[model samples]
Target: MSDDGDDPGRAGTGEPAPAEVGAKWARDRRNRVFLRRALAGVLVVAVVVVLGFSVRTSRLTDESGAFGPDLAPVMDRIAAENAEVEKNHPGAYVTVVAMFPMTGSLTDIGLNRESIRHGLEGIHLAQVWRNRQPSSPPYVRLLVGSDGPDDWEPTVEAIKARTADEHIVAVTGLGASTGTTRRTVESLSGSGYAMVSAVITSDELTGVRGLARVAALNSEQARAGVVHARKVNPGLKAVVIKDLNPADSYVKTLARFYTGSLADRERVMELSFDSSTRFSGTVLDVIAERVCNSGANTVLYAGRSEQLPALMQALSQRDRCVRPGMTVITGDDASEMNRKADLNMWGDTRIRLFYTALAHPAGLTLPGGEVLTAIRARFAGDDPDAFPRVFPHESLGDGMAIVHHDAMFVALETVKAFAREPDVPSPQDMANMLTSGTVAVEGASGPIRIVEGGARQTKEIPILQLNPDGTSAYSGRITMTDGGPGRS
Candidate 1:
């Protein structure tokens, strides 16, 4: 090769390499370093995304998480189903609060409300809520007031506080007595919610707009008893031996209705009972004064069954001793009377004690019986029967299961209605739907339609009369001769 000292292509040329070549070399080195760093960063990000996704999926699908030991297995299943429902359908929740009865003469009404009647109906409602939307936020909470065998004040206060902060739409309990329930109802009135009661039997709950009762009204029961008595004994004379004290509002109402400007008005005698003599000499002295002294052949007992033993004790002490042929009719169930205590009606077949059942007529059957059977089958070990067994009357057996099934149906229907409506229904909306006279619901008792006054459908009450053998049977069906002001 020639020396060519000025040639650019020469190894020791005075000129540098081409600008493009120099730039390409530097760019290749930088690109290699950048590629390595970018690859490392991408790998780190990939790992983080996978971990986060795994955590989120686990939380959403895992049954072992979130709900602690407090929820029953059935409740857990319901909750899971509800979660799935809410996931699919946003902005939907079902909430239930039970105001149980506590401390009062009408505590028996509480037992019937909690275990046998309305309280049990509430639990069934949860199942209904879940069934309605098995994959949503089963927004159901039961704040059981500590009224049954415990102090319910704390529970009541806690719920009251929660109500202020939260959007609770419907309420349905505290069926202690009309008074206790009324205390609760009055507190929640105008808060815009509906309360459906199963056993608070007081007729006073009518026309409150948001309150509905599932139990037969006290006035209805009294009228049924009177009609049944009259049907069985045409010669019956009316003598009302009522505890005219303030505690017995049912008696007061009955007195007003029975003595409503009738020609036989003087036949009705009003007796006053005080704290000193609840079922003592006061009740019997009054009974003796009305039936024995005044020649009243038939008498009506409007007091509690607990008072019955004392009344009988006093009657037995009398000189004449509940004279024969003295036909007496009472509203209390003789079958539920103390089996050991002598009611003294054993020989006198003319004397009768009556009561009404909240049962449905024979022909009507509840919906979803087969579905309930299947649910029980799948959860045989888990006791799906917990809600249904609330009404444990073996006499009717499965026939009585209609009560719970119908309650569930009502709850489910309400949930569906809430879901489809343009507005997310507040509690009051649900109450309105339930209490609206237009909604004819088939309930556990019978074809339940809330009349304009918020009372359940009136069934033909069967009059059970006690026989000399200490057993009772339905003498006849009782009908309401008139719908009085006390009735609504």
Candidate 2:
């Protein structure tokens, strides 16, 4: 058992332990193969993990760059705007009932119907031009109601039915007396729609909670007129007038203020014209000559535009003119005033006249060229009867179109305001917004701002005078002293 080279336990074959050596060699080879395979597998797993992380990072970067800060604000604004549009502009059907005098000589009043429809169409065009923006509800449908020549009863019924249906959002026209327009307005006041009048100038209409006016009130515009008259005739002392009615509110107010403005030492007389007596050219001429010869060079002719041509003709027959130190008259509408002053324009004398025009900046162009051209296009096939040469159809059409342009612009801005607010809007909501808030918008009429009380904030009345060459230009704007028209 203990022999070193060949003990008893060793038999002495001398072949040596080949089997044990072979087994040890096999064990070492197996360990090395296992290590190589494990290293290769780990390398493959690491490569896969790095590639996955890189792909995720790249995707996140792409997403951030595509929808970055620039897009966020725009998206937010659009969503906000659309939310309001959905609330307000639900159906694209807006019913508008237009009431006007359609009988008598005023059958032509409905002739202005084409004008109103064209105005709405123009407004809708402007909106469409705003890059296809979402529009407020009610794609303006107009319904016209007329009574024979000046009867407004039919208009009242139409308005009642329209409002009762709760489909109409706005009403326009009713161009009769203020009383009839008032009835139509009162019927719809509680329905939460707006009432817009074209030429009704009575002051009482403005007090209604839901009505707005495109034409200036005769009572309100009268203020600047008197102030202007005084500016021209600083020493103007008296107004000789034939009062149609002594108790007429218009006559009373005008007389009271005009007399009060003169120097205390000056004497102002109010002459009453006989109601039964129709004034003839010879009579008016005699009166003017007598008045001019008697010391008072300044006279205020307070009458209708129809009477102006006759009055002026009588004065001309007597060699009198509306120049300073002669006679002066103020008129309401441009067409009528320009018509009566037709012959006066042929001469070289300076004539001072005043009328209210829709205020606009010099050189501001409307959507269409020359407002008259646009208005006429609407009547292309409808009414071929052209206006008389003396009517100044271009000027009248331009003026009225400019007014409509301004009103439409205000309405759009109001709609935009509703579109931006968080609350949803109905027609009622829009009317309420107009009552409670104000908006400043650049428009065809001019830079317009609607005040909280629904009155246009600007009092920039246009003042034009005829120069020696008979051309007219803006002299200056007489700022309104108070809210009301001046007394003269």
Candidate 3:
């Protein structure tokens, strides 16, 4: 009983027997090995997860490297084309970048592509007229592409890279979406590149330096919509369907302006849906119930072109809201309502539909009218029906196309004016000149005077109504004096 391994005396001695001590050390060694292996496995998993994320991010944001296709070939083509123009005319060639949304939620209906074609045509026509005198004909090289949606980081990176490497002096063409144009301006403004938008009407961009918009402001459009709604129904009860695309703050802003502009006699019910949401039967039923309960005789859709068709279909199916004398109002995004599919949606509906836009060719009267007529005449020589093709939908007759033309005209004129100086101003200087409100140019949209603070001083927005027979006719015009909303 006194043996060291078995006796209690060993425990009281403050030292274990040799066999017991060896066993205890072995147990501690096994636990340490297990912990080390567990930590190694965790580290391996963490590294793999990080690498996967990095690859995904690289593919999304990196355009210059192998992660995405480089736009160098496109740039080369533009340069080659400009070089040919210079070879014939022998003038100082100035490169202008045209950034279009070729791919995104904005281009779902092919309007962006059509806009690109029209914008390029406008630039080329201006070049031909300006190049008549070989003394200093400006040859414009356009770098065009779609900046991806959401962050548009890929397109922004490509633009920055091209601006640095290609010597781009000015940029145009951000399409109709406010979100796209805002992100684009923010990206290029830092680099001192001047930008012009064809149809971006966000009030938020009013005072942004280095950016000028040719279209009417979103607030102006909303005011026009309210004016037209009240005209159609003196005591209008309206339900507004707002497309809540976080990227496009303009829609929400327009809705707010519309609500605030309403008179005490009028009542407005506001409802919002994300542009990406696909409305199901339950959702549509809820919307229909809301519209019915609100007793709204007019429905205003403030959203993109793609969302309108589904919304119209959903609302039309609800008998309560699809009755006679109901009025539906929309903005320029619905400019293509004459398209085959969209036209059919309004074919038998008893509700009246109207949209607001700049002047149509049929009714456009300004000093710039002659310029557009000349350009259209030249285009007609090649194809008499080119106008219809450019603006296939809506009877507005290439009104949006004319806006694009005006955008190019403004950009070219600005650059040409700067070129006349003894020393060409830097990009920032040119931007300052534009935003200074001193630069007044005759554009297809009429006399475009960029007022101090970047608002284009122009009057006249046409409201086109869709007849029951599926044809659009001019309803009225909204004219702004001193940048305040007034309908004529």
Candidate 4:
């Protein structure tokens, strides 16, 4: 009462009332509580998103069966037939095992599976031909196995085990990567097994007594690519970016051959990175800087298809650094880069990209066209719906499928030749028969000639150019001669 203003509702020295102070404290507490709940909610959402992404990636990389849903029944029938033949006449049936990559880069796994399916169809066609011969031919059965992505040991052991009990005359597939093929070859070297790869293109695999390939050697492909690049831009300065994967010996060999193919008039520079290396912003910046500083009009990339999206992104970011006439050249993996899902990433780049593939042009009147036609007819007659799944309607010109069909054709022919011999040949004898350069089978792609040193003599290579509209066009063709690559 002495005007001290010490009541509970008022401050003692001109401060706010007690009620106002309590209200402000309550509001601050409420705001802090709300903020904490909001933070918790955000953290939960972040975890969920991360987990969902991780699961999706895991599913994509998981190991899959050797055959797709549509083709598994076909394989089952072949297996049953093989069992019956073995029961009736031991060692009378020749078993060919196709080793494919069921898990790895998503694009590769899918392509490998598709190739295997079409290759099996080709074998079926060969079987029909053999049955119609004047004299009965030995039964040929195909079995599929997967080597996964990173390891080939399990698949190798399985092959060895099957060989011990069955008449597995030859081994094929494992062409998804050079490392897989090399490891399989090494495993079967002393084991006396014959291998004819559908797509393995490494020159290093040449001269392996028991191995043959349908696709051109990686070096050959590289030479073709370089020749085409030079033709497009005469006296073009090029910078080659090679992915160094010890497992994929093809990449290293490609880099070496490509750089060597450059003429003296053209300046050349080589750079290397590992397959596992991520193309981060910093890395792309460095690559762009290198290309601009070197004054290179051409950039050649020799690596996996999975890496192309990142490379395209990197290149797009450095559009300012890229010269007006810059072009990118790649190898057979170009189809992977042309996926529809990746259109947005590569469409805006506005850069000229050309890639070389082991393919024959569509609508070409070639000797092997008959075989392809026959195979298609057979597929239509057998299972039309399933045929579309294995041989996708759009994959009439898929180089991988074409090569696989050719490989199967060669393997079937080799087996047919051995079955006709007076005496049953040993596995080593069969291997010799394939690599001896004495057998030639005409296939859908071309003449399947296993020349000296177990190398396929590829006659033509298709070059595809990626347009700004996300469409690919057949730019031209290159022919590989005894000396080098020439325009077709």
| Top candidate, metric TM-score | 4
Per-model TM-score versus the true fold: 0.62, 0.57, 0.73, 0.74
- How well does model 2 score by local distance difference test? 0.43
Which run of 10 residues does model 3 get worst, by summed lDDT?
Answer: 1-10
Note the Cα lDDT for every prediction shown: 0.46, 0.43, 0.60, 0.62
* Comparing 3 and 4 on lDDT, the stronger one: 4
Candidate 2's displacement at residue 184, Å, is 3.7
Q: Report the backbone clash tally of model 1.
A: 18
**Clash number for every model?**
18, 14, 1, 1
Candidate 1: 10-residue stretch with minimal lDDT: 1-10
Residue range 1-488, candidate 3, lDDT tens digits: 11001222245566654335434433443355356557866765787788754222221111232211333333343445566764653323455666665556553322544444555455444444444433333445555556545445676676565553334567777665556666767877887767777777777777777888778887888888888888888888888777676767667676776666677567567887776555533454466567766778888877766566556666666667666456888777666554334346543366677888754654444333433444444333344334444334323354655676667767777765553343334567667777778766655555677778667886577788765444567776777767567746
Q: For model 4, how big is the CA root-mean-square deviation?
A: 28.7
Model 1 misplacement above 4 A: 1-93, 104-143, 147-156, 163-168, 261-268, 275-282, 313-323, 330-350, 360-412, 422-424, 466-472, 479-488
lDDT of 1 by residue, 1-488 (tens): 11101113325755444333323433443355356557866765787788754211211111422223332343354455546544643333444554544344442332331233333343444444344432322244333343432334444445555552233455554443434455566656655556665555555656776676655566776666666556555766666665554544444554554444223643556554542254455656566654565655566665554454445444444444365445445543232341323445343443445555443222233232212333332122134443434323322221123343444445434544443233335666777777777555544344555666567665544455544443455454553333422221
Off by over 4 Å in 3: 1-83, 89-91, 107-112, 133-135, 150-155, 158-167, 280-285, 336-338, 365-398, 467-471
* Off by more than 4 A, model 4: 1-92, 104-135, 149-151, 278-282, 320-323, 360-394, 422-424, 467-471
What is the total number of backbone clashes in candidate 2?
Answer: 14
- Model 1 error, position 142 (Å): 4.1
Model 3 clash pairs are 338-394
